[model samples]
Target chain A: MERRVKLLGTGKYLPARVVTAAELDEQLGLATGWTEKKSGVRIRHYVTTETAAQMGAIAAKRAAEAAGVSLQELDCIVCASGTAQQEIPCTAALIQEELGLSRTGIPCFDINSTCLSFVTALDVMSCAMAAGVYKRVLIVSTEIASMGLNWKQKESCVLFGDGAAAVVVGQTPEGESSRIISSAMQTYSEGAHYSEIRGGGTMVHPRHYANGHEDDFAFDMDGRKIFRLTSQLITGFVDSLLAKASVSKKQLQAVIPHQASGMALRIMRTKLGFMEQQMVDIMADHGNVIAASIPMALHEAISQKRVARGDCLLLLGTSAGLSLGGIVLEY
Target chain B: MERRVKLLGTGKYLPARVVTAAELDEQLGLATGWTEKKSGVRIRHYVTTETAAQMGAIAAKRAAEAAGVSLQELDCIVCASGTAQQEIPCTAALIQEELGLSRTGIPCFDINSTCLSFVTALDVMSCAMAAGVYKRVLIVSTEIASMGLNWKQKESCVLFGDGAAAVVVGQTPEGESSRIISSAMQTYSEGAHYSEIRGGGTMVHPRHYANGHEDDFAFDMDGRKIFRLTSQLITGFVDSLLAKASVSKKQLQAVIPHQASGMALRIMRTKLGFMEQQMVDIMADHGNVIAASIPMALHEAISQKRVARGDCLLLLGTSAGLSLGGIVLEY
Candidate 1:
C-alpha cells in the first residue's frame, strides 16, 4: 500500500502586545474605521524584535509535543520564514540547535516562496515522506513583518503583524484517508515588484546603505494591484485544486486563504462562490502574518472545531514574488 | 518497480579573473607558499561586483538547455547560494524571472547548509521526483565568497573564490542503473560558530553599526577546529555510505570533498585509506566556493572524462552550520 502523508498536529504563536485600530489611528493619523472597513484588521500582534525566532521555536515545540514525538524523532527540519535571523546557515539549523536536536542527523533547511512558504514547505515535506526519505518532518513558518514596517507609512504598517505557526507531518496508512489530496502552485515574476522589501539583497550591498531609500528598506506595496491579482489567482488555484481532488465546491468544509487583506478575502469568496460561513478568516485579529497566515488560520479553525476528521480543508496562499499555491487536505 | 531520480545534465560557470598566491602577496602582503603548503590553494576565482548573479543564472540556463528542456518545462527551482542577490523573494525567484520561466507554476526557493547545500538540494529533489510531485526540478549551487571578504583578513581573504554549478534532476525509468544510490547527512550545530559572517544577521542588525567591530562583517574562522571536524566527519560519513551501498573504498572511482583546504583533504584521505589519485582537489584553483565547489568539481570531472558511465563517485561536503553530507552517484 502506498504511504500517505498526514497532518498530525498544528500550533500557532503570536507576540503578547496587541495594537487596536483606534490606537493605531491615533499613532499614525489614519481615518476612523479604516482598518475595519478596508482590511477588517481591528487589532494585531507586535513583537519587540527580540521575540520573533523565540515565538517560532515555541510554536514548533508545541506542535511536536502535540504530535506526541520528541525532538529526536524528527528526521528533517524545514522552516519557512520571510524574516530570518541571518542570510546563511538557514534559520532551520539554528532552530534545530536551540531544540537540542542538532546531533540527530536530521537535515535542516529553509524554504521561501513569500507568504506561500509554509504551504510550499508542506508540499516539499509531503513528497519527502511519501518517498521514504523522511519519517517525521517539522515545518515552521515565522514572520517578523513588524521589523520591516516604517511607522510613517500607515498603508503598509497597519497591514502586517508578527507571528509564527508550525505543523508536524508524517506518513500513515493509506486506509486512514486523512492526508493531503492535491496541491497546485503558480508564480508570476512580472508581479514580484508589486510588493517587496527592496533593500539588503546582493543587488544592494549591506554596507551601501543611505537614508534616502528608507521606503525601499521597509515593506512597500501596490495595494490595488495586489488585491486584484490575489483574488483572481486564489480563486482559480483553489478551484483547480478542488477539481483535481474531485470534490465539489460545496464539499469543502473550510477555506483557509492567507490572512493578507480582508477585502482580498471577500473578493475571493465572491469570485469562487464560497459561502461566508465556509471560509476561515483570522486577519481581523492577527493582521497579515505573511507566511505564517495560512497555518495560523488552519490551526485556529481546527481548534475551534470549524473542521473535523474526514473533512476537506482548502488552503490558499500568495505573496511577494507573486507566488501562489493551494492544497486540499482531508483530516 | 520504484522509480529512480537521474541526473540529466550538469553545467558550471566561473568568473573570468583568477587571483594567484603571488598576486595575493602583492594585494595583502601574505607570505608565499603558506596558502599552498597549508590549504593547497594556488589560485582562486574572484567575481567583480557585477558578475555574481549573472554567472549563476548562466549556469542554470545551460543545465536546463542541456537537459533538452526550456525554462517553461521546470516545476521547481532550488538555488543553493551562500551569497544571494537579496534576502527577500529568494535568489531562486530572481533567477526564475531572469530566465523568463516564472509563469510556468514553478515554485522557486533557496536551500543553504553552507557547502553541503548542493547535495542536500539533490537529496530533497530526489524525494520530490520519487513521489511524483514534480516532473522536472532544477538545482543550482552558487557562491561569491569574494564579496564576503575582508581584504585585511589574510587568513580568509586569500582562501576563497566565486563560481556556480547546476544540474537538472527528474524521474527515470525503473531499473535504470545510472542514478543516485543513497545519501547520508549529519549536522553539528555545536560548531556553528566556527565559520560565519558575524555582523549581517538579525543578531547584529546592520543599522547598529558601531565603530571597531569590522571583523563582524568579514567571514571569521577557527581554522584549527574546522580542520579537526572536517577530517573526522568526511571519513566517517563516506565509510557509512559505502557500507550502505555495499561498495568497498577500493571500488570508488573518484572522491569530491569540499575544497576547504588541501591539508584537510590529505588528512581525510590518509585516515580513510584512499588512493591520492582517486581524489579530486580543485581547491588549488577555486579555494572554497562553499556550496558551489562540489558541483563545480563534478562538472569539470565529467567534462574531462575523469567520471564516466558506470563509475562510482563519492561526494563529501562540509562547512558552516558545521553540516556534512555524502552521496554516492553512479554515472
Candidate 2:
C-alpha cells in the first residue's frame, strides 16, 4: 500500500510594515481606487528589514513548533520560492542557517514553479516521505516581491506583497488523522513570458545591469492576458484534477487556491463553482505573496477552523509557467 | 511494494568551441602552465551562441531518444542546475519551450544544491518514481558558469566551464533492471558563504546593479578553505555514507564523483584508496561543469563501458552548501 503523507502543522509570517493599494496608487499616480477595485487588495505587508530567508526562518520555526517537531528532527527542508535571497547557495540554505539548523547536515534545496512552487514542493516532499527517503520534511515559501518591484509597472507592483508560509509534512501510518489523497500539476509555457523578471539571471547577466531597464530587473505582468488564458483552461483543469483525486466538489470542505488577484479569485469562486465561504481569501490584506500565497491562505484557514479532522481540503493554484496545480487531502 | 527507480538513458552536450588552459593562461597573463598545473584542466567547452536552456534542450532530446521515450511520455522535467537562464519562469520552462515540448501541461521545476544539484535531483526523481508519482522523469543539469566568471578571479574562473548533462529515470517492475538501493545527503552550512555569487538576488537587487562591484556579480571562491574543511572530514564522511548503503569499497565496481578540482579529485583517488581506473576523472578536459560534472562524467563512463548492468556503482559528491551526497545502486 502507498504510504500516506500528512501535514502536521502550518505557519505564516507577514511583515509588520504595510503598503496599502492607496499608498501605491498615490506613489505611482494611478487612479485612487484602481488597485483595490481591480485586484481586491487594500493593504499588503512590505518588508522593511526582514529578508526573504529571514522571514522564512520565522515561519519555519513556528511550523516546527506547531507540529511539536524540533527543527533538528526535520530530515529535509525545501524552500519553494519563485525568487531567492541569493542565486548561489539557495534561500533554503540561508534559512537553514537562520533557523540555527545549520551544520546539522540535513538536506536542503529549492524548488521553483513561480506561484505554484508551494504545491509543487508539497507533492515532491510527499513522494519522498512516502518512499521513506525522509521522515519529516519542512517546506517553506517566502517571496519578497517588493524588492523586485518596478515602480513604472503600477499593476504588477501594487499586486504583490512580502510574506512567508511554512508547513511540516510527515509520513503517517494508514488510518491516520490526516493524509494527502492525490496531487496533479500541469504547465503551459505559451504564457511563460506573461509574468517575468528578465534581469535576475544569466540571460541578462548582471554585467549589463548598468544599461538594463527597470522593468527587466523588476516584476512585469500582463495580468489580463494571464487571466484570459487561465480562465479558458482552469475549469477543465480543475475538473480533471478533482477526478484524479476521486473527489467531488460537494466533499470539499475548504478550497485554498492561490490568492493570485481579486478577479482571478472571483472567477474561481463564480465560474469554477466554489462557494465564497468554501474558499480561503487573504489577498485583500496580504495581497499576492507569489509562492507564499496558497500556504499562507491555508495557514489562515486552519487557524480559523475552516478545515477540521475528517474534512477534505483542496489546494489549487496557477503559476507563472502558466502552470496549474492542485492537491486534495483529508485534514 | 515500492517501485524500483532506474536510469533509462543518459546524454550530454558540450559546446563546439573549446578553450584550452594555455589560451586562458595567455589571455589572462598568468604564469606559463599555471592553469594546467594548478587545476589540471587542459581544455574546456565555452559557449558562444548557445544559452543554458538551449544546450539543456539538446541534451534532453538526446537523453529521451536514447531511452526510446518520446517527449510526450515525459511526466516531469527537473532542471537540476546551479544557475538558471532566467529567474522568473524557470530554466526548465525555457528548456521545455526550446525542446518543442511546451504547452504539454507536464510539470516543470528546478532542484538546486549547487554542484551537487544533479545527484540531489536524481534522488528526488527516484523517490517520486518509487512512490508512483511519475512513471517517467527527466533530470537535466546545465550550467554556464562562464557567464558569471570574473576575469580577474583567475583561480575560480579557470576552474569552471559550460556544458549540460541529461538523464531519464523511470520505474520498472520488481523483477528486472537496475534500481536505486539507497541514497543519503548531508549538509553543513558553515561553508555556505565560502563560494557564492553575492549579486543576482534580492540581497543585491538589480536596480542597484550599476553600483555593484564586479566580484558581487561574479562567482567567487575560497578554494583553500573548502579543501581544508573537506580534507579534515572527507574520510569520515565517505565512511558514513557507505555504511548507510551497507556497501563497502570491495563491493563497488566503479565510482562517479563530481569533477570538482584536480587537487580534490587527487585526494579522493589517493586518500580514499580508489584505484585510478575506479574513479571517473573528466576534469582534465572539462574543468568543472558545476552541477553537470557528475552526470557528464557518468555518460563518459557508460560509453566507455566502465559501468555495466549488475555491477555495483556509487555516485557521490560534495557541493557548495558543504553538502556531502551519495547514492549506491546496482547498475
Candidate 3:
C-alpha cells in the first residue's frame, strides 16, 4: 500500500533587513554590480537581531496556524538546518521551547546532510507518516549564513542569505491521496570539499583557533568546480528520480529547486526542458539560503497560487555533501 | 498493522590507544584513583591516527559483512553522533567518502539528539523500513569526545572515550516477526544547559576564539545536576514507554542503556526494578562514548551471548537535550 502525505500548510520567515548588492559591494569595497553579475543575487535578507531558532519558531507558528492546528498537535519536529545555533540540545528542541510548546513531549531531533537536509528530511517525515508513527510532523529548515560567510569570499558571501521555512505534514484527507510519488538521492563525496566550513567542529578545535586558515572558519566554496560537477551530475539524478516515481517533467505543475545561483538555475531549467514559468526561482531576491531555499520557495509558490490543490510538485537540490536529491509529490 | 523491524547485525570499533585513569590523573596532575571513585570509569579508548569518520567506516563494514550484505546493498546510512568531525558535509557523507563508496548514492544523513541519537536513529530507520521506502538501513554512532574534553574539568574529561558502533537494520525475514514494539521520548528544554559545549558551533564563532572562557571552548558538565534530573525522571520514562508497548520489565531479556556512568545505570536499575544481570554495563572499560555508548553496549551484549535470538531487547538513554528515550524490540 502506497502511503499518502499532504502539506497541511507551508510558511517562511525572512529577516526584516534586506541588503542590496550595491550596499554589500560598497561595504566590502568591491565594484558596484559585482554581486549581481557574479551570483545573480541582487538583494538578500540578513538577520540583525533574529537568530536561526527564532526564525524557525516564527515559521513553525505560521505553518501551524495555516494548517489549522495548534502547536501542541504536532507529533514530531524535525529540524533540517544546515547550521545549528548550539551543539547540545538539538535545534528542534530549542525551536519547541521558542514556540512556547517545550513540554508537549513530542519527539524532536535534527537530520542534517547540509543543503539537501530539507528534502532528505521530507523523505524521513514521509516514511514516518506512512508507517503511522506520526500523525503530524513539523519539518523546519533555518539557516543563518550571514553570520558564517567570509566577507572576503565575494563569490559565496554575495550569494548567500539567512531565512527559515517550515511545513506541517500529515495524511491526505480521506477522499484525496496526495502522496510522495517518488524520491531519490545520489551522493558523490569526491566533491565533498567543493563547499565546506572545516572549523566550528572537532576537526578544528577552538584551542587551535589561532591556526585558522582564512576560509576554514567561514563558509567557502569553489564555485566554478561545484558548478561544473553539479551540472554534470544533476541530469542523471533528476532522470533517475523521475523514472523511479514514473513521473514525467511534462506532468509536473511546478518545479521548486534549491535557489543556488542564477547561473545554476539557468542550467537546471535549460537541461530539464522545464518552462521558464514552471521553474520557481527566488534566488534574485532571497539568494542561496542554504537548506532553507527549497521550502521557502515552495511556500512562496503556494502563497502566490503558482501551486494549488492537485498540483504535482517536484523538489530538487544539490547539497554540500555533493549530494543530489529529488522528491516528487502531489499538492 | 504494526510494522516489524529486526536487528540484522551489529559491529563496533574502539580506537587502538587505551588511556587508564591513573595515566589521565597523572597527566592532568590529579590524585590517583580520583576518576574511578567519581565516575567508575577505569579505562577508556583514545584515538591517535583514527578519526571519527574512519572508525565509523570500519564499524560499518563489519556490520554489513555480519549481516551478509555488501555496503552497496544498504539503502541508507544514518550517522548519529553528538559531535560532528566537521561542520559541513555531515559525518555520514565523510564516512561514505572513506569507505570508497563515494558515488553509490544511497540516501546518507545524520540524526542527533545527543546521546539518545542511536536510539532515535533506530526509530527513524524502523519507520523508513516499515514504510517500504528502504529495505535495509545502516546506522552509525561515532564520537570523538576525547578531542573536546576539558582536561581541567576532571569530572567530565575522564568520563568520556572515543569509539564507533554500527548496526544493519531490516525486516525479520519470512515467519519471524522480531520488531520494534514501541518507543517514547520526552525532552525538557529547561535543562538544556545542564551539559553542553558552547564552542565549535554557530553559537560561538571561531573568530571569538581569543575570548574563550575557561569552559566555553571545551566540554563542561554539571554532573550532579544531570544525575539528579535523570534519577528523578527516568523511572517514569521507562514505565511510560513499556506501557505504550504493552510490555513489562520482567519480559525484557536484556536492557542496553547508554553507557553514561556506572552511577546513572545503578539509579536506573533500582528505580525500574531491572535486575543487575538484565542490564549491560561496559562503562568501566569503555567509559562514556557519548552517542556511541548504547549501540556499542548492545554489540558487546550480543557478541557475548548475553542477548540472543528471540530475546526481548530494550534500548534506552538520557541525552544532552535533557531528553529521555527508549525502544522495545524482540531480536
In candidate 2, stretches whose alpha carbon ends up further than 4 angstroms from where it belongs are A1-3, A173-175, B1-3
Runs with alpha carbons beyond 4 Å of true place in candidate 1:
A1-3, A49-51, A173-175, A211-213, B1-3, B49-52, B210-214
Worst 10 residues of 1 chain B by lDDT: B201-210
Question: All candidates' TM-scores?
Answer: 0.94, 0.98, 0.97
**Better lDDT candidate (1, 3):** 3
Q: Tens digit of lDDT per residue, candidate 2, span A274-313?
A: 8888989998999999999999999999898888877999
Q: Quote the lDDT for B114 in model 2.
A: 92
After best superposition, candidate 3 residue A129: deviation in angstroms? 1.5
Extract clashing residue pairs from model 1: A201-B86, A202-B85, A310-A331, B39-B262, B310-B331
Worst 10 residues of 2 chain A by lDDT: A206-215
Give the Cα error of residue A265 in candidate 1, in Å. 1.7
Prediction 2 TM-score vs. true: 0.98
lDDT of 1 at B89: 67
Q: Which is better, 1 or 3, measured by TM-score?
A: 3
Q: How should the candidates be ordered by DockQ, best one leading?
A: 2, 3, 1
Please give the distance, in angstroms, between residue B179's alpha carbon in candidate 3 and its true position after superposition.
Answer: 1.4
How do the candidates rank by lDDT, highest first?
3, 2, 1
> Which is the better candidate, 1 or 2, if ranked by TM-score?
2
Query: What do the candidate models score in CA lDDT, each in turn?
Result: 0.77, 0.86, 0.86
